[model samples]
Target: MSFVGKKYKLDKSENFDEYMKELGVGLVTRKMGNSLSPTVEVTLEGDTYTLTTTSTFKTSAISFKLGVEFDEETLDGRNVKSIITLDGNKLTQEQKGDKPTTIVREFTDNELITTLTIGNVKCVRVYKAV
Candidate 1:
């Protein structure tokens, strides 16, 4: 219930590399990195949650539960199947598909910090609740 109706942002500096790596990329992707700033809005209600990610590049939306599997895509257009579970105060999103990635989000310093990994590159993005 506490997690319901809460919002967060990505801490780009600390999470970018991790995110991309999880998406299945190597140094090549990092070398050709694009300047992207993604923001996420989360609304957890009852047994389901709605999450939205938006940036200059693309926007994605996801709705799922603790054990439910759902489909999602990255800003660069990578498809994935995702399932989110709670680990203490953090939420871990385990993604499956052609690109496997894991994203972790937690509340820190009054902001939401997210980390992503594709292959070798990692990235972090941060957002403040609005």
Candidate 2:
């Protein structure tokens, strides 16, 4: 039913480097991001949700409520205002900053698929439950 309490490990990524480039990420950071496999854990507590992404480089934990806007510092070191909305099994996030982007995460068949859209670039990342 819910995607909470599950841990998903990054399986593969498509066009991730291009997407990071669109976000103005530097060469070194892009290479680091591309080389690392991150594990994402989603936890729900009433109306609040925590999404934790952990990798060899770093771990990022974000906590927010549905429809509430919060400040976020992206992995690439960009600060933005982000809001996440849940629709059925899909969670969509809009980050407002100098370079706005949209992220959509959908859970299906025990897989969490994420789509990142920035300008004309789109990247898909697949994660499998672990």
Candidate 1 regions exceeding 4 Å error are: 1-3, 9-12, 15-34
Candidate 2's C-alpha runs over 4 A off are none
Per-residue error for 59 in candidate 2, Å, reads 0.2
| Model 1, span 40-130: residue lDDT tens | 7778767887878776656777888887888777555678788898877688888787766777877654678777666665666677765
Model 2 Cα lDDT, one tens digit per residue, 32-127? 999999999889889999999999999999999999999999988889999999999999999999999999999886899999999999999999
C-alpha positional error of residue 40 in candidate 2 after TM-score superposition, expressed in Å: 0.6
- Where does candidate 2 have its weakest 10-residue lDDT segment? 1-10
CA RMSD of all predictions: 3.7, 0.8
lDDT winner: 2
